[model samples]
Target: MTTTPDPGAAGDDRRLHPWSWLFVLIGSVRQFLVPLLVLVIFGGRREDGVQLAVAGVAVAVLALLAVWRYFTYRYRIEGDSLFIRSGLLERSLRQVPFSRIHNVELRQTLLHRLFGVAEVTLESAGGSKPEAQMRVLRMGEALALERLIRHRGHAAGDATAQAPEEDAQTLLALPTAEIVRLGLVSNRGMIVVGAALALASQVMQDNLFRRAFDFVRGEASGYVASFDCGGPSLALAAIALVLLALALLRVFSVLLALVRYHGFRLQAHGRRLTVERGLLARVRSSVSRRRIQAWTLRESVLHRLFRRRSLAIDTAGAQLQGGEGGQSREPPELAPIATPAACDALLQDLLADAAWPPRDWQPLHPRAWLRLWLGDLVVAALLAAALCWHFGAWGLLGLLWLPWGGWLALRHARFAGWHVDARLVAVREGWWSRHWRFAEIDKLQALQLRQSPLDRRFGMASVWLDTAGAGAASPPLRVRHLPEAQARMLYVDLGREIARRRLRW
Candidate 1:
């Protein structure tokens, strides 16, 4: 490991690794791949030679630009801030103060590892983009930079004088078995399959649906010819084929999980929490304990089958990158998959103050079931009416949805609840795919009390709590279907508590 230089020193500019130009070139190629493919496939006219020459010139220009970028980009650490200067025709300089930096991310792809280099990104709160991004730096230099930022608040002399290796307590580490369990509990395979099908539809000249149907028909014909069987046998063969496809999908999911979380580890170093994971593309991200805005515990039917759950956290800088090409913006996962007991213990260890899994979960209003059922009833009635208009009395079958919806609503009402303690407020919903979302009283950014027309009829209302850095996909922290009086009281009390406490993030 390379020791970081004194950040207090001035005029020590540094350029990125020499191989950064290659990475830049690769990125440019990816952006232009489609156009290049078009030229290769269709440029066969009389001016073919001229077109090829133009393409070659363009490639050369891009290569030169990549090299130029490498030569121009420079950074230096000076007095509690990082100064960066880049661009030629569009000259610009940026200074990022250490106090404002919230997260430091290091990513290393397989190619980066081969070259002993990594990409670094510095994130801050409320930023639409990273405060600073260094394309490629020596692995040791990247670590040194991370350390420098991690201890920027320390006295100037201690920043660089600290030992290279700080004691880190490993909070969680996942083995291959745990990763496999995560694969089984996740729907990543389905997502991958959907994306692949979409890509095939766009890239293949033939109609994708037609191609699939023809392939399936040919396979069925071959199977029937080989077995010399009738409808029953053909049906069985089709079932077998479907089962085989499902098995293949599961295997793919397992492989993906293995590749992404192969050596996952979460460690605590003083007040910082660091997560390191991935096989081919390693990522190490660190966030301060005070930066976390909310916590979530997730469990699905699949998780129950495996007796496992996952924990994730929303940080103040979670969305700082805003879609950076090489960086992920998803909330950090503390445990991808762990035994329920293990997850609880980890939560207790981290939170210590707020009790993990609140014991006294207050149920919603007794008529909350009716409120839920009525909402679904309106949707089901509209659907049944649409079906009835299209197909005579046969549409009455659509009404069957009413009973099923009512049953589901009742179950959800029974399972959904909320809990409030001095330090934290927690809410849980959903019976089949349940999740518990919580945030400290000091972390709550806003509160809302909502009452729909139907809710009014039932004399019920809902309380919603907002937290900074909550992912768009995360469920709202809502206590729904509470008695109007209770909801109002809870809302006012929470608002007062939030106002009294200083916001942490």
Candidate 2:
């Protein structure tokens, strides 16, 4: 049921580990937990018999399938391609040419850590998920397979996929201290805590959390009935509770960062970047320099306070969703935390041949502040008025914080700038959370110039770019609220760039 970590285990051979059933068992439990929880919440004791029967059937089927999967799944390298055989009742054989593979990732879950095995995920272009996934291979073998695939991909065309030798230069390595810093700089603490609270809320009525909730709701006669508190005291108590929750969430977030980014390292091999990280579930993944579509530099409120930035790249592999990419799906990250100078260096290193620096930043329209923040200003005014109407003199305190929102709008206006160079285009925006994003000028799949009713009134327009497979959520680059002439000029320039520069992707 349990296995010890074995770092030196060789994965050069093609075989699944005997202990992979443990992973299967865990997976089955997770798959069932949500539905089981829902059933218990809805049916209670009345449907206990049906629940037990359904659970029993589900467990038995999952267990049998797990065993069969472990027995049936096998992966091997044959000549220039990787071959996989899986499934019991309906056997399937898949062969992937090295050229077609975009990325190969080695992921180790808690099970892999225990059994000294890793999951190998192969990703190709245009699919719902990863092309193929070989679970529970020895760590050494996984690396070897990835290296072989990289070599094949290189021989086929690209030379800088990855080099799994000992002499690759280390680009960045984050120690435990930086991981803690990353946790502190991240805003995910509250999200984790909120998720846990939501999970607690779904407990069965007879369960401990449910009982506690009922008591809090005055089910316990003395709980709320005996509460004799002034309005100010109640408000203070509510605030205290909120702070306590946030504190706990932050602690949880720190632990998550510690586990996730323990021993995180980035290495460079020619034109390839390799990343290895995680404490319990280690991952080793590599991306080609050419595959990267764009770069994003983010500085959250906490990050700004700490003077740190998180740099990430959106590669073809990150955007691609072929078949079942699974663990191979994560995007390449330069550094989770880095200084401004380090960021500049990393960006330069990545774009060594293309362009050195972008052109001078041209700011958005001067009246962009009114266009961007007018709605927020109206909402703030409405809130202040409503509060004053309800609480009279006391509500006037809301006006004290009104200036903060106005100041943030000013900050947003000041930070909004864009630049277009010979090879790259960049955009910078945001107030509390600052962002600077860059994309290749040549890779512009679509360029749009538009004016909304408000923009028309202000005689302004916006210009944005898109890459292949990129959704509306995050375009490669967008510069909003520019003057109509400037927006149209940039739009025409991009069209010329698209025609002049040959597209690689």
Candidate 3:
């Protein structure tokens, strides 16, 4: 079954689900959990009776506010704008035009699912926060509102009254096995472990590392005493333990991936693409195809080992939302984990004109390896000097980095290349961990040609292409260590093309 809007009820004001106050209360409590915990822990002290009273008052105030908000908040659709009236003492009315809305997000937690409701957020460009957020709405009502907004409130005759098709064509659907591969390819486990360690260090009064090291040492000493093992055996045992810990972390990562991306599906409805995923807390989000600013295809060493790659796209209004409450700021991934051939097919289907996997990739300057190696050499030298001051002559071993750096630089320079066609400009770089960043020529917002003293000395320069909504995690679309003349030619050509074309976003 699908949501169908009633044409006659378009102008009537609507209240959220009756249980919205409960969700709002839960959210407020979560937001203040830390402060409340602190107060409760200290409240037992004879000298801190005031804190106890304050905590009690705060809880009551929050509950009252949640209920008041539910009673006061009202919204309605008037022509092409969503009109909202809220607040009791400081009354406010907001009108958000449907044309200006860029994103409509529907979130349903486990509790929300039990109640068959969803939280709706309406977002627009250049806003620090969502334009409007409905705490809770019936599943059908939320879907109906989303459909109304998607059509910009201009659906004709029976179109607005009709239900959406239940069997819409799905572009992609990830299975549980693929999610496990994604977890294996990602360093999310390491990231989570590090964050946990950092948090523990902050929360504990003792030096967390010192305590951990002491505990490990005690356990190792006991094991050695019990087994009567030699130093070599102890060393092997330590290595085994380390490996086991890493394995456990990988398992944790797999569990996390399953929880976040379970039943992940991507669907296309006309010019818009929608993604729905999550195990405990379902999220449904969509972005217009035209709002996509840049695209990235990433393949790390692990990804290559698993025969997988991921494709991510940056959309125009994503950066403005700030992703409040620990939510992801990164734009949704088009493909979290897919084979090379699958990735190529998706790109071909989505961006047919640009040509998938350009064959005519132009290499950078022949001497680019020299420039890359020189930079690495200087860094190695500085590190060696710093170590020598601390460890005397023994520290010269730090120079061992030179050979590895030189090899990497040579390989990177050999493989790095750029491609430009009538519709798209793309750059690919890296050796062990590789990625390709590209965008349509019309999506290009800025072009920069940069040269440092070292670059000038090497007679080389770099060109950077900027696009709207570029994510911090994504690599810059830069062609580096190019001959001065070639760099200038590319910069001028791209600049002229960008100037001639109107930016799509």
Candidate 4:
């Protein structure tokens, strides 16, 4: 005779939310009905009443079965892992470790928003598989689950590393009003919303649209009038009126877009960064100081004229990772948190608060000037010649910038400089619009020393520090025009530190 498994062990493997199938059945039935109805309508050759009834019964039965299976789906927590068991005949179990969690994102779709449900997603860094996602969670439960994970996963040293609760000063905290102003100035929502409205309108008017087809085939458009214009002047007037209406609608769309995306705010509370934005659907995201991968400071042409800059942080795998960082060695992550001067001030304040020693300031090497100009000249000349050959006289526009932009690039490259200390590395680059990025040496992942053929001839090399996720696939801090030997020595030092401080996954 064989001994049975312990009841505790059996119970640990049990699942919850057996009633979740009710929602799933409802959703499946809703999804199946439209296609079934379409088939009934289009299969005109059949004796439809009997066929329709049989199909309806089949759909209903399948929907019921789906609902039953959904309700049977469950999950259980065992030690530091969560085990999910799903499917009816083809049952399976998935186990996820709490330590594997990198980020827990709560998603609210239109349906979830209406039902007050949430979708919880657990992301793992450098995982072999995609992140695990749990759907159909109540909002409160999802948040609670996320909090529990964070509490469990946070390192023991995290508490002591936090800035002093009593003495810590808040800096660069954006007021709600300022957030609103920035949102308006940025106008991202206006562009996005307008495109959405245009798409929606096109879909509604298209003949292939489901609703449009239904309208035409059913009694939905019986009273609609057909346009039969006889005069050119009246047609022209109508066209003009339509254009005017479109212009007014565009203006209104912009206003609506602005309202919905207003009041963006970012604050530095001790070592953590907090961002909150959106008018209708507010979002609040927070990250600890140590999690930040890089820092980016930017100024657009308009902002440059206004003497303002945006400060952003690059948190690897965060929202800021997709964009290109202008003249920066670091991967794009955080950015445009504030204007130029404000960002610089914020950086200074952050360094002081962290108790990190300041970096040793140094300008771009003198050889950098020659390299910049030579590279720019060669590139610009080739581009100009190509444009002229293709476009004939019209390519003068491209030719106009042959020397001008190249000269500017060279000038800017000369101004680019870097500084390093025992704890921090800061790189300053760009000309009229400058950028300053700073990170701790402990955060770096790798160091690269490079030498071009011309650079070898010049006896110079470029040094790059790969910070956290910054490298070939991402952005990193690169300082060009160092002596070859000097770059190698620095690379050696960085590699040694990287080995000492590196934490393996």
**Clash numbers, per candidate:** 0, 12, 0, 21
lDDT-better candidate, 3 vs 4: 3
Writing each residue's lDDT as its tens digit, candidate 4 over 1-505 gives 0112222342254433343454455556666665666566544556548668877787778768866675656766676666778777788887777655544555454555667665555644444333454555666566555544543454333333334323435455555554444543454655666787676555343545666557755652242223345568567766886788666655564465455434544555444554444454443344555566666566555456656676655554443222122122333223344555566666666555443223456776666767776766677677767878998866666656647766776777676777777667777777766666667776677778898999998888888876544444233578778777877787787778778885432
Candidate 4 residue-wise lDDT at 337: 40
lDDT of 2 by residue, 1-505 (tens): 1222322333232557776665666677786788876765565576348877777788788888888889888766666777788888999888888777776778887767767788777877566667877666777667766766666775332754454466688888997888988988776677776787887666544477766876776654464345698778767766877798777877878998998889898887666678889888887877766667788888888887878898887766565432232333334667989877778888888787655445578898998877777767677777778899999977767665557776777889998899887888889989788888888876677788888998999999988787653433343578899999989988998888888877754
Instruction: Assess candidate 3 and give its lDDT.
Output: 0.82
TM-score, each model?
0.89, 0.84, 0.91, 0.64
State the TM-score for model 1: 0.89
Pick the TM-score winner: 3
Which clashing pairs does model 1 show? none
Q: Model 1: how far is 284 from its true place, Å?
A: 0.9
Runs in model 2 deviating more than 4 A are 1-15, 18-22, 37-43, 46-50, 87-92, 155-157, 160-164, 203-211, 214-244, 319-331, 354-359, 381-403, 468-476
What does candidate 1's lDDT look like per residue over 10-74, in tens digits? Answer: 66999999999998887787788767765755555755477678778878988999999999999
Candidate 2 worst ten-residue window by lDDT: 1-10
